[model samples]
Target chain A: MTPKISRFFAEHRPATPCLVVDLDVVESRYQALHHNLPSARIYYAIKANPAPQILRRLTELGSSFDAASIEEIRMCLAAGATPDRISYGNTVKKVSAIREAHELGIDLFVFDSMEELAKLAEHAPGARVFCRLTVENEGADWPLSRKFGTTTTHARELMLRAATMGLRPYGLSFHVGSQQTSVTAYETAIARASALYRDLQDEGLDLQMLNLGGGFPARYREDVPTIGQFCTAISQALTEHFHNDLPDILVEPGRYMVGEAGVVSSEVVLVSRRGGAPTDPRWVYLDIGRFGGLAETEGEAIRYTFRTPHDESDPDHSPCVLAGPSCDGVDIMYEKARIPLPNSLRDGDRVDILATGAYVSTYCSTGFNGFPPLAEHYI
Target chain B: MTPKISRFFAEHRPATPCLVVDLDVVESRYQALHHNLPSARIYYAIKANPAPQILRRLTELGSSFDAASIEEIRMCLAAGATPDRISYGNTVKKVSAIREAHELGIDLFVFDSMEELAKLAEHAPGARVFCRLTVENEGADWPLSRKFGTTTTHARELMLRAATMGLRPYGLSFHVGSQQTSVTAYETAIARASALYRDLQDEGLDLQMLNLGGGFPARYREDVPTIGQFCTAISQALTEHFHNDLPDILVEPGRYMVGEAGVVSSEVVLVSRRGGAPTDPRWVYLDIGRFGGLAETEGEAIRYTFRTPHDESDPDHSPCVLAGPSCDGVDIMYEKARIPLPNSLRDGDRVDILATGAYVSTYCSTGFNGFPPLAEHYI
Candidate 1:
């Protein structure tokens, strides 16, 4: 936890299952990215955590936004961001949403298919649109599938078609994946996007931007490469691929900007062995669970580091199956990859899940099984 | 879709990504269960879909409730259910929640471990409690792990401990699993609970209730056994085990009570081939996705049947990868088990996902990726 969040928890002793975010941590992370990758314009992906306080802070820092929906675009606008500073980044767009965004003076959009391109041409006419290129998500913890992006071959055709349909074929974009660990993933994606960029240039279309969609890493159970390392790798790739005629770089980072700034403080609800021998792992249930915002633990993929009050004083620790307080069968967070918690942890004890700032609050079900959404506090 | 829901859609033409539930279907389903399991007291599991309309109707029908949390218990009370008609059924619960529910006059609680039993004894002293026995979840679509229940050997000890701590060991309960398909699953659970009941009786603790916890299936893509078949199997098992010494049976039915009563109407946001061969499946993006309430599609466990506007007119239908309209990678609903959509399907077309009445609304993220929660409408 950040020092600000740690201090907030100590003073307020806020209710359980609440997220405490340090605003200073968010600003520092943004500045680190800005200093490291000076050439790239950072478009904060607001879908990661669209807290009003976080948005207002980023807006004051002059950060652009990459919105996943019309509501997100409005959130950015509501936070004092101008319409020109937002990009509708999701490739799939509803016709009404497209029209609403267009009428709201949002010109930039994204698409990977002819159908979406056609909708853009009809609804948001002359909007600057980017074609998403299909790329590998090898090293990402939350690897994306072929649910998005198109092959470079198909993207070429789509860009040409967008121009013919009176839409501005502005750029090409690719995401290695979310929580991407390997910098090589970005290198590979840049090369693919650059090849497509050159191919489109030869076709008499000058793409203005190369959108490096968010794949930035956040520290969880393991350490990841620093922001400087990612920026250096990205900077070198752009120099090698585009040479003297480098296109304007646009990086949409969601997780990296705010992930480590927050900690989820939860109360231990129940600790049970369920009739097992002492060798068996005990099940530790917390106030928060999959429905309460830890949806990333669907397959035990994002293993989070945990802290309890007895961490230092209690010498004995044991592996336990971590779970949420919901009655749903699938509310389990970590079962296969058992979490080692202090043996003294029991009901009413405080447990804090670290680095849960970005996704936890938003991913929470409004009130699944009658449990309210995860509460959020930005200090 | 039920005629009422179909007609409601025709008349209202409500916004996309909304769930419409027909209350009459819920009543009929309740009546079906009531008729089939005459000896068993039906406790409508409020966690399935705790809509006020559904709860009030069930309350009017003299149905008891199995609440997962204090909020759910409050909802049941607001719907006119007396505290005596409610049972706090979640095995894992916070101490504060136990105190709150006990103060609200909720006397019945469930537990599977010693730790949970102690909390109940201290917070809800003299209350009636039941021990949950861990049973195999064979032939269940959404099979539960050993997350909520204990072994019979452990439960026997816990019940004995409850009695010693001045709490009534009211009953024994077991869940085969959610969306359970096999009739034999209930039969097996009943047999296990009966064996425990007899063992506990021999030890001088008379258990009054046998909770046949919910595992009832909703018809999705595949047809499950009729409710009659399940009730018959349960009835036969109870008779075989208890003979002339029948106990009060409590059946908690969640999904089976409301799954068929609702339909999720969604707009086709984008339909893309993603530059694939003509033979390759198309990607169908809906206004709603995993975060929008189709969370049961996580591992494609609950395969929902779909109805498009072109289903009847279009002769050519092809397999498609179905996804939600969020930018999240995991939002893709069906990829491996491709859903068949009309070849004519495109943007702006309406698709109705069937049998979503139960888990969809409750499981929806508050607003993942800036999309609002799935709107609910009860007719």
Candidate 2:
């Protein structure tokens, strides 16, 4: 039987080397997340892939937005998301951006240090703020303890300073890290935030919100936990901390909401022999690269499946290395993957790389080397 | 003493996160290569950032273009480079690209296989063809021997087939590898090409050009060999192979032409405590990341100098890890590097990343997580 992907390809016939989003999957994922994490307010991380369609769907699903820049704020607004629903989440923001956010009626901003608070106080004195606390988790896949975020001591100082400056310090926020494999990291971050929240309350400042910044991993590989499992962990953590009575819980999920809903379709322009020694193996170069379909899989090797047109019976799978159109050797998508292809696979063949939605389109350097991205399509 | 880069930043006030090009250094580097290798024709590989100003300057300096796609071909043309001076050097030829090349009057193209030859023959019969021969270099930074070129045996067959198809097989081309630190690798590739050139003549075929594809390293650190040293080796190799008489030489240099010319200027957005057992180390997070200024430094650690605004003297330097605005922990630029800055460096201070022109701009994922490139300005 022909695969569902093949049928989608037949109907859409997207431009080669282009990103395609399945709106059905996107809506289903959004609905599922909302159903599971009913207490937590979802803020679509606009940085993932702020394509209009994806933004529209998320906003339509009643999700707020997490924007990092003026342009991202503009994109969210253009997609009909209100300024009140959009949080300018960059820890260190420019003065101009602070002014712009104020003018746009954007109330919420993230501050990691006293200097940033000073800037915010001078620029947007009345803006509602979230003290971004630095959660130190060395065991997590990404250790965010070294980057942007305030320590517990620093977080208290910043929160107190915001109150002293006549600004509304709404709550606390912390991100575990992107593509976090461990669910315990979220629980630990929430536990830390809970302690910070209580300490700030003890200092006589009533906080209204606690942002558990999104690092909820989408199931890129089979071994990755499902979104249901992730939501359950968050639920358990929330129950332990607030005992089912919490401030407005916020999550800035970028990849989990949209990553698996997208696919990149590219045509095989040429299938030719790449020379190698008898001992060393060869590669089959494709039209996409680290710049295109495989931006997320940088540093490590990944596997992707492919097949030829017409002869679609999982054509004798073989481990072939796939490279992009660029001359750079590092411009590879898969280091090695057992892709199904016909023995006579030649020019004009097509391949669909599954689950490319989140960062692929948004991160593409289309103007690089003068190669613009192929037009994107949504279904 | 003030650095040469100070002037460029003066005119374009080091926008928090942007790329700056020093044209004086770029032109001098261009002239140095031309002065060293008079007999060899130089083609600037536009795949490494194809910025309009850079292209225009290189073209003005009498450098032909090595374009991989029709888009690059068009960019070169728009930059005032004539089509005859552009070589469509990608081995994988698309039918539309072949037709576009023909329409644009681009005569030179490369192919590694007979299948590609047949397609090109059908699309553009009168196109001047070159067969890319695989150069076996055991010791190179990145071995292209396995990916792009055809084997010498297969190359000969492809050349013969091109002759039969009524296509003019003009020359042979091979890339040893990108970032080739060894000078001997070029000689090895030349020696291989020399054998092929001799065999083609012996077979009664007229070959007019011998393309030695570019892998010339731009000196990032002090240890890299000078351009004059590389040219001396190439000069000696040509003298030994052709006895002072050889085909018109073609060298495609991408990084060497523009790497040192560009600098990415970014601001220190946040500095947090990191990577220590509660005693010492801390990582500084900048506005740039693996996605921005450091995209070219893939797989290897990069050391870049950062200076405070307008204050070069008595710079306070410290080793710190840098990260981009993304929440991903892996979105790091320098995992660790000593950056020079004044104690006044707060949230708003700017830092300049030197030698970023080569592959940084071209390889970036612009919309990744909805972050667009920092506005770019050419001085």
Candidate 3:
């Protein structure tokens, strides 16, 4: 019987230091998301592995893009994504990037400050803007209230300023923060945004888009909510707040759209005794380190499933620390996890670290310590 | 008067994140090493930064190189380092890389196993070999007893195996570990390797080199020993062991050669209130992160000094959490460090993180969550 890992290895042997994207999984995920969130438009955040092949696959699945930089915006455009569908969503805007956005015919951009608003006005006088609101959420795993957005009180004034400058404030957006586990956080942000929307309407302002900035958690583990449940809650909140007659909703799901679609495959250079303890042992160090797939969870003990190239029925399992080739002890991915490996695992045993689709390939410290950038292979 | 950061910043203040190298400090460091260890050959480990300009400067100063991979070996060669002056020091070798080293006329390589020796023989028939001995110093901060190097018994056998295969067993090498605080760790490793060298000589093998691998600590903080003292102890030990008739001593000094020569200059994007007493709170998130200069020391709270762009004299000090632009909370460089910043630090304040030369640029993760690579500038 063919092993699951052997199927992947059969298609491609471990290309030394490479990031492999599972196209089948990506396509299935895209279909699932589209099926689940029919009312909402999905925008793939280009920051997660901006390989052209990945971008092209995403675009083919009828996904728009969330671009934070000019380079990202260009990547989306080059990948045949329509400029009108791309949103230049970075709160901070360089004058040159703003001008480039305008030249590229990107209609939507986000602004957080009056200074930024003025700069946007000078660079792109008729750009459509989204006023980012700082929502206070005590329950967020990662609170973003301290950076990138203005308070609700300040956001109202910023929106008014944008109106005075003849900039079209088409939408109101707020990010509950990255990796938000609480579904209630999204409900609260939407309620606050709805109040602001109602207030703006009462004050004789017309708004047509309510972009609840995406933090729909991807299932890094099996416990996270499915996209269907998340979208259902969001749809219910919109119905309760705006009577189902509200503006178009935009959801920018970065990891959710792509996280599971990517896998980082590495060869086991040597399997040796790390000599920590029998219970909580040391590791079987890989060629990749924090410079690769492990960049997603830098300081945390992230769990990654490791399997050998030729293993069928319940491959031999052991808890081993995963370390990189760099001399630094801090260069670890999964400190301790039950990894399934062949009993015959030796030097040159190929291992696949699963479900690293988002934020792994693109964000790693590529040029650090002269370690080469992860080679990318798209299936 | 011109601001200190003005010398590094480009026109229009583009947010091109950069690592800056100070030539004056690097030259002084080189001079200090030359002055103290006049008889010892310094092989600057190219794995530190491997920036072409830095490599060229070190080569010009008569420093040899220690390369870990074919890529690193190629980089040193491209930077004008002769193969004779380069050591293929990494213990594990790919067949192709071994063949490349042999074809390039590079003779010095390290091996820890007989299997590796067999490959080395098949690939590079007449290559000079070094048996990397494992010195198990349990009390040392960096206990590298598990990886790469062979045990004393294994080292002897590997030496014998190489000699049987007609390979020149010319030397013994051992790395105490990175950032080793115990100066005596070197004495221990040297003693063990000396025993191995004598054993090989007793067996009719004439050893010509003692490659004492780098663990020499840089003065990261005032508590760490100065390089002067480190060199003195190692120099004294070599003289004692070989009675001033030592067969060419080679030291691989990576961080010590370049750690103090680099500085990371960044703009403060936001100053947030987090992770300290509410009454006397402390935190400042910079645009740079653990993904940049702090990549080498991920979890540990690194001791670093910071200075304002304009004011260098009044080092307004406070301990604050330094974080990167990534939404991940663990994207912290220093969770706490007394940074000399003005009390009025806000968004757009410029900061220079000093002594980032050695491992900063090389091991950085780029574009995690779409953040761009730190722009690099060499003086």
Index of the highest-DockQ prediction: 1
Q: Candidate 1 or 3, higher TM-score? A: 1
Q: Write the per-residue lDDT of candidate 2 for residues B75-123, one digit (tens) a residue.
A: 8999999988999988876788889898889999998877689988888
As a whole number from 0 to 100, the lDDT of residue B269 in candidate 3 is: 61
lDDT of 1 by residue, A1-379 (tens): 8677878888999998999999898899999999999998999999989999999999999999999999999999999999999999999988888999999999999998888999999999989999998899998889774778888888899999999999999999999999999999889899989998999999999689999999898899899999999999999999999998989899999889889998999999998888756865789999999999998998888889999999999999999999998887888999888888888998889999999988888899988999988888999
For model 2, residues A168-252, the per-residue Cα lDDT tens digits are: 9999999887767778888888899998898898899979999988776665544677778888998899889988568889998
The list of candidate 1 runs beyond 4 A from truth reads: none
Q: Model 1: per-residue lDDT, tens digit, B1-379? A: 8888888899999998999999999999999999998998999999899999999999999999999999999999999999999999999888888999999999999998898999999999999999998899989888775687888888888898999998999999989999999999988888888998999989999789999999899999898999999999989999999998999999999999999999999999988888856865699999999999999998899999999989999989999999999998889999999988899998889999999999999899888988999999999
Error of 2 at A72 (Å): 1.2
- The local distance difference test score of each candidate is 0.91, 0.75, 0.71
Q: Score the docking of each candidate (DockQ).
A: 0.84, 0.43, 0.26
Prediction-by-prediction clash tally: 0, 9, 14
- The residue pairs in collision within model 2 are A47-B369, A47-B370, A48-B369, A362-B367, A362-B368, A363-B365, A363-B366, A363-B367, A363-B368
Query: Which model is ahead, 2 or 3, in terms of lDDT?
Result: 2
lDDT, candidate 3, B177-244, per-residue tens: 76677778887777778777877888988788888887665555546777778778887777777775
Error of 2 at A119 (Å): 3.6
Worst 10 residues of 3 chain B by lDDT: B272-281
| Chain B TM-score of predicted candidate 3 relative to the true chain B | 0.89
Scored by TM-score, the top model is: 1
